[model samples]
Target: MNLATSPATQTAPATLTDFFLKWEKSQPEKIYLRQPVGDAFIDYTWAEVGQQARRMATYLQSLGLPHGSNIGLVSKNCAHWLIADLAIFFSGHVSVPFYATLNAGQIQQVMEHSGCQALFVGKLDDNPNRWAGMKPGVPAGVNLIGFPDYAAINDADLVPWDHIMATCDPLQAVYQPQPDDLYTIIYTSGTTGNPKGVMIDYRAVAEAVSHTSVIMKHNTPNARFFSYLPLCHVAERNVVQATSLATGGTVYFAESLETFAKNLAVAKPTHFLAVPRIWTKFQLGILAKMPQKKLDLFLKIPILSGIVKKKIREGLGLNEAVLILTGAAPMPKSLILWFRRLGIIIQEAYGMTENLGAVSMMPTNDIRDGSVGKVYPGMAVKIDPQTGEILTKSGWLMRGYYKEPTLTASVLQDGWLATGDVGTLDKDGYLTITGRVKEMYKTAKGEYIAPSQIEFGFADNMFVEQICVAGQHLPQPLALIVLSDMGRQAERIAVERSLEDTINALNPKLHNYERVRKVVIVRDPWTVDNNLMTPTMKIKRNVIEARYDAQLQPWYENDEVIIWE
Candidate 1:
C-alpha cells in the first residue's frame, strides 16, 4: 500500500518566509518559540519572532550582499538558529549551516568552500578563543554577527546580534522567494572527507513540511517541538523548524546537554524524533530507575503491566508523545520491541541527506520487525538487483552537491539517487538495510563480513553502549566495544564474564565466518570532540581504524576473549 497516497492533503505554505508571515498574522499572540533562560522559559510570540526576523532581514539587506549570496550559520541548536535561518531566506540569501561541533580548521574549510559573504556565530563553548585560528579562513571583508554569550573574537566587522535586532528597522519589503529558489546549503557531517553541501530548494522544503506535518500529526496548535539536535542536519531542519512553521506549532529549545532531560519534560512534545543513540540513552534512563529483571517480572502481572508502562513513559518524559521516530542509523528490533512493551513505538525511518532524511517511515499500525516500513507516497524506491543498493527518486530530492556536478552525477544517476546503502526489499516493499557497500570488508581468509549485521547482533546486550566489528585482513572479526556507564560501574570481572557468556551464546547462532573472535573494551568513549564520531553520533570507521589498527594486532593475538584497552 502506498502510504503517501492518503486521502488527506495538507496545504503547504508557498515559501518559508510566507509561512512565517502567515503564522504571525493568524496567531500573533501564540507562543512560537520558547527558549530556556535560567530556570525560566523566555517565550517569543509569533509576532515577536517575525519582527526579529524582519529586522534581521533588513540588516542583511543593508549589507548589500549579492542576491543568492551564501551566509554561513555556525551555532548549536537554539532558538536563534531558526531566527537566523528564517532571516537568511527572507533576505534572499542562502543559509549555509555548519555543524557547531566543528573546529576552526573544519569551519574554515566549509566557509571557504561555500563562499559565505558573512558568518553568524552563536552559542559556542564557554571559550571563544578556541576558534582564534578560524578568523583567517573568512574571506577579506566578510561580515561577522555574534549572538549573546558568544565568545569575543578579534574581527573588525563584528556585529552584535542584539544591536541588529534592536537598532535595525523591520524590512518593509520582503523578498518573494520562488518555489525553485535556493533556501539552504546543508553540509553533510561526513565520517570521512570534506563535507558536501546539499542544495535544498524552497519547493522541497515546502513538500517536506507538508508531508512530515501530516505524517506526524503536527496540525494542531498544541503540537510542541523540542529542538536539541543540530539545526544543520536535514532531520532537525525539516522536522522541528519546517514542521513548526508549516503547522504553526510551539517549539522549545534545549539549553545544554545537562538540561536535555529537564527540557524534554518541560516541552512534552507530541512529535519527537531522534537518532538511535538518544533512544538508547532513554532506554538506559528507564532501566536505571527500574532494574530490568524487576520490570520484566512486573510486566508478567497483567494488571500491573499497564501501570508499569505508564510510569515508565511518564518518567522518561515521553508520555505525551504521539509520534516517535528514530533514524540516521538502524535501530535494533530487540530495542524496538523493548520500547513496544512499554507502549512507546519508535518508528525507524530510512533516508539520506540527499533525500532530506526520510524516504520511508514505519507505519504506526503496520510495523514489522527488521523493516524500515514502506516508501512514502510520491517517492519511488527500488533495490539494484545486482548490487543490492537502495535507490530512491522523488520530486523532493536535493538539487545536487554544490559546485560538484561530476560528484553529483555519480550518485544521482538518471533520476534515482544511488543511496550507497545495500539493502533488500521484502515482497511487501519493506526495506531492510543490510550494510553500506563501502563498509563491507573481507578477512585474510577471503570471507566477507558485514560489520553492521554483527553490530546489530550485539545491540540487545545492555552492558554495551556502542559496538563496531572490524576484521579487515584478519582471521576473525574483532568487536571494539564501548561499555555503558552501568557496565563501567560493574565489577570488571563480572562485566567480562557476562560479555564472554554473551559472545558464546551469540556465536552458535552465527555462521562460523561471521562469529566475533575477541572484544576490545575501549577506555575512551567515541565522541565528536575526539573526531571519532560524526555530529549525528555515527562512528567514523576510517577514523577508528586509523586510531586503533596498530593496537588491533595485539588485541587480535591476545588469548583472552575480552581485553581492556
Candidate 2:
C-alpha cells in the first residue's frame, strides 16, 4: 500500500478513493482512534469508521445532494466528526468544519460563505433554543442532522442523523473524486483578525500528509501521540488528523484539562503536541511540587537522579518519544533548556494558515539554540538579505484564500509566499525569527531589539511562565513577566533575602544595549479574550502595551525588579 502518498500525482479520479480504500482493508482491525474518559477508553477501528462513513455517504446522496456539495460540520473532537468528514469525501461532497465554540453569528457567516447545503451538529453543552431559528437563513432545503437524538427526528423538516443512517444506502458512491477536487473548507481562527475560509483540494491535504510523514518517519512505530489541543487549529489538525493517514499510529484524545496528566499515563502516547502555555503550566506545576534546590540535593545522593528523571518522563508519557514538537508561538529558552536536562528534546516550528502549516524547524542534529528549524522537504525559504523579509515555496501551500483572490495575490508573489516574519537565515540554514516585521522597534540608544529575541533571554529562566520584552524609545529594555506561581514564590523569596544578588545571578549577560534595566512580575495571564494573546497564543504586542501602559513608566523608573501590586 502506498501509505505515504498516492502514486497518481496527475490529479485524477479513482486515485483518492483507492488510497483510502487501501488503508481500510490493510488496517481493518488496527485501532484508529481512542477517546479517553475518566477511566475507560473508547476504541474505534479503521474498519468501523470506514463502514459508517460509507453508510453516511450513501445517505447524503439519497437526500438528492449532488456531487461536490458543501457539508457543514460543527462539533468538538469526536469519532463521528471524522467519520462524517470521510463520508463527505467518499460521497463526493466537500467537508466544512466549524468550531463548536463559535457564536451563532460566526457560525452562520461560515455556513453562508462555504455555501454549505447541509449541516451535521453533535452534542452541545448548551443546545440553545434560539439556534433553531438560525437554520432557515441557511441555503434553501439545507438539512440539519443532530446526533444522539438521531433516533427520534424522522420528519422531513429536520432529519435525525441516525434516521438518515438507517434509510440511506451503504454502497460506495459512484462519483470518484479527482485529486484536484475540493475536499475541505477550514476557516482560520481569525487569530490575525477575521477568519478566512481556506479551500483545500484533495491533493493539498494529501500532500500535507505526505510532507509530514517524510519528516516524521525519522522516528518510529513506538511514536505514541496524545491528542487534546483543538483539532480546528491546523497545527493539531495537520500533526494529528492528517498524520493519521500516513502513520496510522494510535491516537488518544485527552479527557479534559483536569484529567490531562492522569490520562497521559493511561495512553502512554509516544508523541504529543501542545501550545506553549499548556507546556509552561505543566513545567511550573511540577516545580511547585518539586523545587530545583530540593531536587538537586536529592540527585546528588546515589541512584536517585536517574530514577527521578526516568520516572518523571514516563509519568508525562514522554518516555518513548525521543523527539517532541512545540509551536504556535515562541517558548521561553529557559524552559527549553530545563526540559533538555531532563532528557526530553523539545523543538519549535513555524508556519501560518497559508503555507499549509509549518515551514521550518530547528533540527535535532544541527540544533540552533534560539531558532525554530531548517526548512522541510519541498519547501524553499529565502531571506531578503537587506530587508530581512522571509519568503517560501512549498507543495503544501494553499491555492489561495477561498474566493479572495485579491488578498491571496498580496502574499503569493511569483510562487513564493511572503511570510510576514522578519528574520535572518544562519549559514547552517537555521532561521532565527526575530519578530514580525511590524513589531521590531528601535531604542533611544539607536539600537534595534526584537521583542521575541529578548523574550528568549528572560524565558531561559525556569521561574518565568512568559515574558514580553519591550522598550521602543526608552533608555533600556523592560520585561513584563508572568512568573510561574512556583517561580513567583521562589523569586519573591530570593528578592526579599537578597534582591541585588538574585538579579546579578540570573540576569542575561547583555551588551549594555540588550539588557533589561528592570522586570515586572505579573500574576495575571495574557489571554485571547482579554486581548493579550492572539488566538494562536502569540503575544499581541499592541494589546499588551495598551492594557499595561499605566504600569510601564513606574517599572522603567525602577532599577530593580518591580512587583505589580
Q: What is the C-alpha lDDT of each candidate?
A: 0.84, 0.69
Clashing pairs in 2: 224-270, 224-271, 334-459, 334-460, 361-372, 361-373, 361-374, 362-372, 362-373
Q: What is the C-alpha lDDT profile of model 1 across 264-296, one tens digit per residue? A: 888888878889989889888888888999999
Clash count, candidate 2: 9
Candidate 2 on 1-565: residue-level lDDT in tens? 0001112233322234565576688889988778775698878788877777888888787778778888988765666677787788888888888765565566777877888888887633333443453454456667887654322133356666667677766765445677678777778876445679877787766665555555655246734567766566778777766665556667777656568788877777666676778777767766767888887776676678788778778878788774578888766666677787777788787787777776876677777777777767656778876667888776667777787899889888898888888877765566777777767778889987777766665543566666777777677888787766656567466633343344455455656777777777776888654557654566777667767778777778875565554
TM-score of each: 0.95, 0.83
Question: For residue 534, what is the lDDT in candidate 2?
Answer: 55
Candidate 2 positional error at 188, Å = 2.5
Q: Measured by C-alpha RMSD in angstroms, how accurate is candidate 2?
A: 5.4
| Weakest lDDT window of 10 consecutive positions for candidate 2 | 1-10
Q: Residue 136 of candidate 2: its Cα lDDT?
A: 44
